[model samples]
Target: MITIQDIRNAQENIQDTINATPILQSGQLSQLCRNQVFFKCEHLQKTGSFKIRGATNKVKQVVMEGAKLVTAASSGNHGQAVSFIAQQLGVPATIVVPTDVNPCKMNAIDAYDGNIVKCGTTSAERIPRAIEIAAEQNGLFIPPYDDPYIMAGQGTTGLEILEQVQDVDAVIVPIGGGGLISGILTAIKETNPNIKVYGVEPETANDTFLSFQNGRITSITPTSTIADGLRATQPGDMTFPVMQKYLDDLVLVTDEEIRRAFSVVMERMKQIIEPSSAVTVAALMNKKLPLEGKKVVTVISGGNVDLARISELMIGTERIY
Candidate 1:
């Protein structure tokens, strides 16, 4: 189990390496929701996502232990984060990704000089392939969301949120394999148990939601959504229990709702966030959570988007006025 001390140590471990992202109040959203809305701008974080904190922390630990090579599997963001951080730390890295991963993320991994290996279109395929490669190369395997180090590293964001927003009544975060929310839940609940932490996910990729509802780890057949980063078939072994223990609620939003949230953030907030990052906002806008007259923090998890897809996503959605 992850402890508060582990999160604090992770903060110290990646203090200089990670960005302390700003928490900005969204005036328009506040007016709409009748609550003080603060957005943790993790999209502005290194590698255009919050994955860097965990990736850097894990890489640092392994490299200090004389690890010369590392391997990871990601749909996109985690792959880029692991590759970039490993390259910077002088540890050779290999990243296995699904063939359907976003092109922009693929390009970023290549730019980081990570050896790219392509596999089938699910974690089941990508993970085993990457593990095989890691064994062959005698390298450490860095899972995207399952490791304790990764969870602790991601907890730093929650620490920042607490420092940045006072009297925060609730924090809404998007969930995939449950890493980010797991860390945030640990940090926030351990420090201030009164503060509620809710998780959001695309309706199509609602593994975490089902897991939360069923009182056990549950999985869905992998489905496609605009929130591609949140396509995990199931929650991580380490992350699920943490989430079940601390998460106040789990909400699901449709792809259309996510796209609408993405459009609003881009046009009104002037922020470029990927679909996965927009799910929290989608939950808020759809009133899926109880946020009336409260101070709410929404985590904008990533901004690495393929520009060409924006027009397609926004085609039928009307802008929030």
Candidate 2:
């Protein structure tokens, strides 16, 4: 298990390459949630997502140890992060992506000079393929979620939240493979155990919630949702235990709620976040858990959506204009 010290080390490792994204508050959302709410704007991070933190941390160390090639399997965001960092370090990156990967993400990877290989869709299919490619090419495998260095790096977000927020009473984070929330949970619980950490997942991607309910790790074939980043079929062995130990609760939000939250943020906050980031906002807006009158921070995971889908995502929600 990783400790606060490990996260601190990751922070030091990533500081030069990673962006310490800003923390901003929306008065509209604060009033709606009845809490002093702040958004950890990781969407504005390098690679347009928080994945760069872990990718940089992992890649930096491996490169120091003489690694020449890096490989990862990702739907989109993780691939972008890995490609971006490897390009910076002059290390070759091979990202095995799903066949139906978002073209915008693929373009971003290509711009970073990542060697792209199309594999089967879904994590279950692509993960092993990426690992095989890494072994075949004598490359270092940078996992998307289930690695100690990666989780420690992601925990840096919680450390930043603690430093940035004045009186943070709780934090709401969106969970996929449990990497982000697990790291946040460790960073919070180890330092300030009183601060509640809640994990939110799309109802279709409720593996962590089900794991908590069943008293062990569990698997579920996630149904499709607009919150693509939260679609992991199961929590990781490493990440799940941290979540089980330190997470205060788990919440599930529907795709409809995600779309509404996406619209609200787009129209009112004027922030173009992806639907995955909107999952945390949806949980807060729908009052999935009692957080009334508390100082809360919601992690906006990323904002890397195709522009063409903005109008489609905003459907069913009223706009001021």
Candidate 3:
């Protein structure tokens, strides 16, 4: 539903506010995968995630369209992005969160001055609630991943990666609701069809993988993967077609693998990447694909982990020897 030009326009629209997050080379990953590896560090973006890119674009559109307020259903990062951008634009935001929402993300939203509401724990529950609240208040509802404008804004990340990294042959992205990967796929394929785009997901939260295998959107029970940001129950309807058209492959990593990658990034790279951000590296560390002589980039989705849970994260995993 979005064109590359839409993405380019989004780039123009959000550039003023969003950081063109840096791409840093991972020498350890390069040795492990036998290829040059770089990280697109969206964890350093505004609101500590790339969600701001899309959130800024969507909220700006709504404001121009005369929306007095906005509502959204999010587990954490998207809510933070919406709340943060809305605050900057002098608009109010209501975030309907799941009962099991992460405290770190909730605190960020609250800090951004978002109106917080707790609803049922699933998107199936909170999504309807967000729409209902929008209707009740005559406000606009912003979907996390299933909208064209959101995808377009997210695609701007891919554009930056292309500019920052020369002749990249592949990119790996973490998939939650499929918005980020769908956007990256469009940006890469439209710019250079030869650059393969792959997606990684938590094994416990592999709804997008199931969707690809089943040739239709499939739902799963909510998972307890440490990668909370990757716990989407299903792929987006609008995003599915884009994956089918342009995506190269999908892979899954266990929570154990995710932990290993997380610790490695912290201890070696000295970067405190959240678990969801580690899935791409987990795929690489697990040698999920052939990359003996390729240039690859992994999109680190976000870095909003709850510090109170760091001990919990390292419980089952050992430090790198």
Backbone atom clashes (below 3 Å) for every candidate = 0, 0, 0
RMSD (CA, Å), each prediction: 1.1, 1.4, 1.3
Model 2 backbone overlap count = 0
Best by lDDT: 1
TM agreement with the true structure for every prediction: 0.98, 0.97, 0.97
lDDT of 1 by residue, 170-264 (tens): 99999999999999999999999999999998999888888877889997886889998999999999999999889899989999888888888
Error of 3 at 61 (Å): 0.5
What's the alpha carbon RMSD for model 3? 1.3
Which parts of model 3 have CA positions greater than 4 angstroms off? 315-321
Arranged by TM-score with the best first, the candidates are 1, 2, 3
> Ten consecutive residues with minimal summed lDDT in candidate 2?
312-321
Judged by whole-model lDDT over C-alpha atoms, candidate 1 comes out at 0.91
Model 2 segments beyond 4 Å from truth?
316-321
- Pairs clashing in candidate 2? none
lDDT of 2 by residue, 1-321 (tens): 889999999999899998889998888888877888899999999999999998998999899999989999998899999999999999999999888777888889999999999987677777899999989999989999999999999999999999999779999999988778888898989999999999899998888888989999888873678887777888999999999888888989998889888888887789999899999889888989888999999999999998888888985544321
